[model samples]
Target: MSFTGSLVLSGIGGLVYKYGGQQSERETEVPVGFQSLTIGFFQARIRVFRTRLETLSRTFWRQLVETSGYKYPIRGVSEMFRSGAYFFPWARAFAFYLVLYLTIAFIYFCTILPVYLALLAFLGPIGFAIAYLHFLLHSNMLTMMVMRFTQLHNSLFDLALVHNGKEIFVKTAIQSPTLPKRYYVPLNTYYFWLNYLPWRIFIFGFGFTVLIVLLLISFIPIIGPFIFNALISPFIARIYFSRFLRLKKLDNKQRNDEFYFNFGTYVSFGFVAGQLEILPFVSGLIYSSNSVGGGLFAIKALDSEHAAAPSGATAAATAAVSGSQARQDTTVA
Candidate 1:
């Protein structure tokens, strides 16, 4: 039997086992008559499932918009360029990326060129394999840049939050112990490139794992690569999403807030983001920005949720700033 055929049969059996087993205790009649099941019970199950589906949809979009790396980056980049301020950070981020790319491409090319020559010398014509390998390696090197620009933009958003139309936020950010001080050079260039290391590992690892799994099931031909990628999309989205959020927290010098995403919200939203990521480059841009959008969205939600109750991160930041001020006062006194 084909893999897909087996999956269909198993899915049916599993569904029956799950729902039937759930109500089995209530219906003690062995080989319980299909006639014994009432419409009301079926309706209740349908309602429960519907509610879950609704929740999943909402949560997925929420996370994608609030914290995703997909859409927010593109939009954020656009906004940054349009504003005409902070031109240096945007330029600096891309420039650093360019430098890193050229450097890596050169090094990898030099190292791998010998390997390529050996393959040609020993094996003779091997189709496009060598060329493809070079391309693949170059792409990998560039992906080392991963979320640099987006993270830089998001970090700026944090400052934007504190400043909120005031000029002193820049001064405060520079002087404040809690808030990250630098804006352009290190902030846009080194910090994000360094920060994205784990994210790069995750994307590469996940992609490689999926490839392995696909190979194992290659004979079955049931689960195509696209279907498989879609299935694992949420997990991938969550990996990047969580990384970006944590980086944001670190940038703000705020403690981690584990409860920010609540129960299934984070994972479900990741799923949605992953699904939307089907369209090649454009989807990626949208999804990245949406991730940041989702994050900003969630922050806004938190602001409302805790309108009466203050934010823990904000409170701690305030305390740190206050302490710094106190120390300065003591020095003067």
Candidate 2:
């Protein structure tokens, strides 16, 4: 895996530096053919994955271990049961949905268990592969449900962020109710669907194609799933924190730039979040937890950036203080 990752990074870097550098020049100089275009597309994708893999630094791994984000899953589960007027109603709704979801899943699994076992029997030694594929199928099939769950709990996520911020003392994260609100629509609203359906269709169509490719990749041995996870990390990250990103008022272009600029950090964060989300029975709960976790990450990230980057006012204030100190020292001398 290391060798493959390194080789991919090295090769893609060179290819991008060569063919990717001057797109207009290349388009003019060499007639763009289907073959070249296809290669270029794949090259771009490779570069993206390579950049993500390269971003998994040792410090990131350490932070992953230390960060409270990983605990938010259990925290989310606990929050669901916590006693509060605000939480009780939502908790009951979640409980009802969970019961219904699990009941249906139980029946479905009972119906499919014999067939699954037969396949396992036939596959024998490769039963693990079958099981893995089944898990992936189940995980990917829940994408729509995941999105719906996210929509349902958007307000909860916002509140969780506020709570998390208070715990960590990040003032910006503790935003006010009077914050200039963006126009909002409920997920189930007709207007929302009307505006979103076209985009949803495109996303689903593209996602189905990607799913087929991932299924093929899963046929590979151990490293296949790792590679698959790595490739999808960025998308997973964005989806998990889509609401938080919007809350931060990052327009599409700004979000894209942020993702590219901090590609490594996002990938590392997403990879961990994705792993937790791959579990079968608890994935829905993890979805809720992921909102909180993603929020915590965003808070810490913004705080770190804020600390590292002095604001215009902060810089001016610091400069003024320094100049005053210099004058006082000169007078004393």
TM-score of each: 0.38, 0.50
lDDT of 2 by residue, 141-228 (tens): 2332333323544556666656655434333534533231222234544323443344457766997688668745743434455556
| Shift in Å, residue 238, candidate 1 | 9.7
What overall lDDT, based on C-alpha atoms, would model 2 receive against the true structure?
0.50
In model 2, which runs have C-alpha deviations exceeding 4 angstroms? 1-93, 96-100, 103-118, 123-150, 165-208, 215-231, 313-333
- List, residue by residue over 1-333, the lDDT tens digit for candidate 1: 122333444345434422321111111111112332334334433554464567566664665455443444344435444554545544554454455445545654566455545555554555245544543443332223243223444444443333234234334544544522111112233322433344347766996687558534422222232354345554444443443333332321121123232324454454455444433233434433444444443455445556766578988898699656433221111
Candidate 1 regions with alpha-carbon error over 4 angstroms: 1-70, 113-174, 178-256, 259-333
TM-score of decoy 1 = 0.38
Q: Worst lDDT window (10 residues) for model 1?
A: 21-30
List the lowest-lDDT window of 10 residues for candidate 2: 21-30
Quote the lDDT for 198 in model 2: 49
Error of 2 at 154 (Å): 1.7
